[model samples]
Target: MGSYGTSMAARCCVTDTRPTSNPWVVLATLLAIYIVNYADRYLITGLIGPIKAQFAIGDAMVGMLMGPAFVLLYVILGVPFARLADRTSRVQVIAAGCVLWSGATIATGMASGPISLTLARVAVGVGEAAFVAPAYSLLSDYFRPERRGLAFAILGLAAYVGQIAGQAGGPAIAAQHDWRMAFYSMGAIGLLLGFAALLLIREPRRSGSGEGTVEALPLGQLARCLVRSPAYLFMMFAFGFGVLSGVAFGYWGPELFTRAYGMDPVAVKSAFAMNFGLSGLVGMLLFGALSDRLARRSMIWPCRLSALALGAATCAILMASWAGSFGTARLAAIPAGLLGGGWSVGFMATLQYMLPPRIRAASTALFLAVTTLLGFFVGPWATGALSEMMGHDAAALRLALTLIIPFGFLSALLGWAAAGRVERDRAALHDALSIRPAAPLLARPAAEKG
Candidate 1:
């Protein structure tokens, strides 16, 4: 098994040593595109109330729109798009996706009923499926491994920024005009950004074997390479479970404020946006720099730090969910926001570090597919179903979110498990890629094994 995996990794083509373009400019353009990507994706969550009222639907239906509608095609097409990126221009793939999803977002605003809305969302998913994995692959080539933690962290800001734009700005626009107008406005912005990314972002030479070489590993071999790494397996599940709680909260949090406290939707979204967004921004920068520094000593520190942060964040999420008053809930969200920001930087940095360049995009797509299917599909849908079963009240919603606490703990445990095996996996990857001498697999001293 180990030898086969090594052969598979060794099959990867060489990376280009020549610089392709300005790394900072590429980063800036990709970051801007990502902001639009996330904003378009989550805009519907902010308008859920209006959408539900217009369609005369329940929480379950809303969950269907939020989770299954978007995630189904996103996961289904992600790997194929990633494979295309592995062989073609990742920049072009991303540009096309941007245009496609932006068009879908506009279509969403024109949907006449639930069916039309769902179809539009499915289209959005198809478009979005092209972005993340390819983006990560591009970033890996543009920035060196040491700087990736910061670069990815800077990129990670899109999540919070997009969330704020979608969750807060969408509602604000809806309050001023209507829900459909929010979609139209966001979609238009995305179209312009899509063109910008196409024109401004240059694809960097991949960083493995030799210049101008692209290797297309068979799907079976790619699967074998990923599965053979225990760290990758554990890390994948850790990411999936960690994101479960976050997806649920992100989708339902504003509703919780409105239902539990009778707060206005616009005000709730804006407050949640500010509280979570600013804290998350600070946390991402702090943890990104910290992880990079600690990584100099051992890669394990980043994973350990991620686990610790996630565990603490879970506790804070529970506190926010069960808080009696709105003020208390907002206060509790501060810690959750801060700690929740750590996982992405660690996960992205470690995943890229452990894989060869040829497989990076495809592997990332697979990882996203699994995590999105598990977290994005299950999180919102389960919460909605559970809430309905418990009588669909504020208390029921709180309990439904409470059920997510165990998954958070499980994620942390899995992260720790991944941390224990990361060094070994990284060593094996290094040997496979022939970046350094191939040390005897079992000859390492016990002290250095992990």
Candidate 2:
């Protein structure tokens, strides 16, 4: 089975051999975009109660805003833009995306009602669709496989900070200055960083050397490329369920506190920031590092032990939701967040493991497609829709959020099965290390390259 080799190095987005002057600028630019990315993506949660009250919408509509509306275009746009990133300067694509989405966030602030908010959200999804596949690919080229986890974890740090700021701070900021100011500020930061990313991060030459040869997959051709691997299919479902459950927790967390514990807005904000935000921050870093270490030891970490552990943890977390005391669930939140963060470890590992170097971006895009279609689109909306059908009561919310437990367990089972096949299945994957061909006397099939 394949595992990234050992190396210890770090740098901003600046390329090593390239004439490009400052990679840190790229790092800063991407980090800034991530901050804006998360802020725009999540600001709705912060504003949800007020927005719902203003528009007379229910939790279902609120769920849709965070899910299907944003996720649909996000899934669609991801691959095509990733194709462009493989062919062109990733920096340019990211800059353009930043501009599109940042502007969209501002328009969201201008939204007077639900339909406009939904439409503006679609635009935000479209814009963001162009960013991630390319950004992940770009960052991979600059950082060695060993260090990429840390870089990505740092990138996730920006997201966690944004989550805390967007969710925890937004309500408070909106209370003082209006949600419009928060949206405008987030958008403005993106616009400024868009230019900066263009300046600082030079695109590295496409990777196809030590680890592997580049087998370029063209745009519109990614679907066929996905059919070869059983592991990929399992990973898809695994990643989908993991992300879906995470979004459920993010969307309903504050409301859960309100309905169950009768906490006021201020207390909710504190929990959102300290419990979810702070805990999530620690979770991301810890899980990222842990996955890398495990992946190094176990070639099949992507579909291996991580999933087994995650499934068990998820079951316990679901029960925590029904805890008699808010303080108990509050204490439980720290470990729950830590385990929840493990999803990214598996998710990113799947991307890195399932494809060879050349097709990484396209594979990532396709992966995002599943993640979007299932995780973002269905998860939150399902919770809210179920909640409405059960009536506007606490019991309904409890039922809806709790459904994720079974799905998470199901995902873990699939991953464990995939891991069982690692010895029989992953022998072909061992050469995923160095790119050069073995002797013609022992040639393996090309289709098994990843």
Candidate 3:
């Protein structure tokens, strides 16, 4: 093995002082918290029909509520919170965020109009911003790089499970009572989980190069470092574009099903949730494990895998959107879910490997802020605006979704490009951190082997 490979292997094999709680237990707690976090965020998507009816809003307005209202505060606060996590206890940062977002979710149930709902959503964003970066950083300390792929995969399951809860469970609750009840129930559950996270999870010691403790870079230095890395830049945009279509579909897919097939909202969402959830579960685990094993041979494998999977996924989603019937749509969803679900696992694992420990959380936060703006903010809002311009019909919605297909293809290309740059960039990071670099593990392309 080369120096980079040897260092990574050593990190993986070294035993350290164990945390008070088991690492698996810690992972479970983080997973639960993450599930609740996403469930609260996506509940609005599931309740769009009821909320729109109650507020008498247009599709453009609904888009604003779904995209800007939540994402504005989320992307804005993410870096600051991640910096705090880098300096303080990540567990506390995450727990506090869970509590804040849960409370805001409850407030969403009480909104009387669009303005109030937007405000409540903004608060939810504020809390959610604290979770992802810190949680990923903390997990790195608990599980070594070799194991992180599986650990993150288990955590990644929260996204699909949460989607099921919010996209499916929300409508079910609203059906039983009203849309407001959905928020109430999800919020209450989140609040309890927040408290549980604080009580149950213990903070692990941060890992670093054995030569010395590495401190996080200041905001300016961090920005410069990210800008300097061609691989990071490519991957960041690739991730952004990769997720754009999926986010649009998640926000609008249920409504499309209802309008296109005249299916009941509850039934449509339930079916969507089940198809997506099961397929995603399998895909996440499979790709995560595959990435880890393949990466032993080459770091570029993760990016290569992501690019291929995303390209295939784009085709699947296009088919699902234009399917003739709900059954056919469900069939299409199986491939879409399987292919689309694991993109983040490889992206994130590769990113974590490239960055130093001190800045991992903050760097992740910065990366997310950009991607969230590109994916979360732009996807839903642009789709809604296009739908409204096109008369807000089923065909218009389908066309809008179709337009997003090109972005997925673009993402795949960029991911492939990123693969060529990752090993070089990772080596540069090691040099910049003053860590010793080992011999080459595998020969790289002449241009990228630096």
Maximum-TM-score candidate? 3
Clashes of each: 5, 4, 2
Give lDDT per model, in order.
0.84, 0.71, 0.85
Sorted on lDDT, best first, the list reads 3, 1, 2
Scored by Cα lDDT, where does model 2 land?
Answer: 0.71
lDDT winner: 3
- Candidate 1: lDDT over CA atoms? 0.84
Clash count (model 3, backbone only): 2
Worst 10-residue stretch by lDDT in candidate 2? 433-442
| TM, every model | 0.92, 0.87, 0.92
Note each model's CA RMSD in angstroms.
6.2, 4.7, 4.3
* Regions more than 4 Å wrong, model 1: 1-19, 430-450
Writing each residue's lDDT as its tens digit, candidate 3 over 250-305 gives: 78877888899998888999899889878988999998899889888887888889
Off by over 4 Å in 3: 1-15, 18-20, 209-215, 435-450
> Mind giving the per-residue lDDT tens digits that candidate 1 earns over 187-256?
8988898888877877767776464768677887667667767899898999999889888987787788
Which runs in model 2 stand beyond 4 Å of their true positions?
1-16, 20-25, 209-221, 302-305, 419-450
Tally clashes: model 1: 5
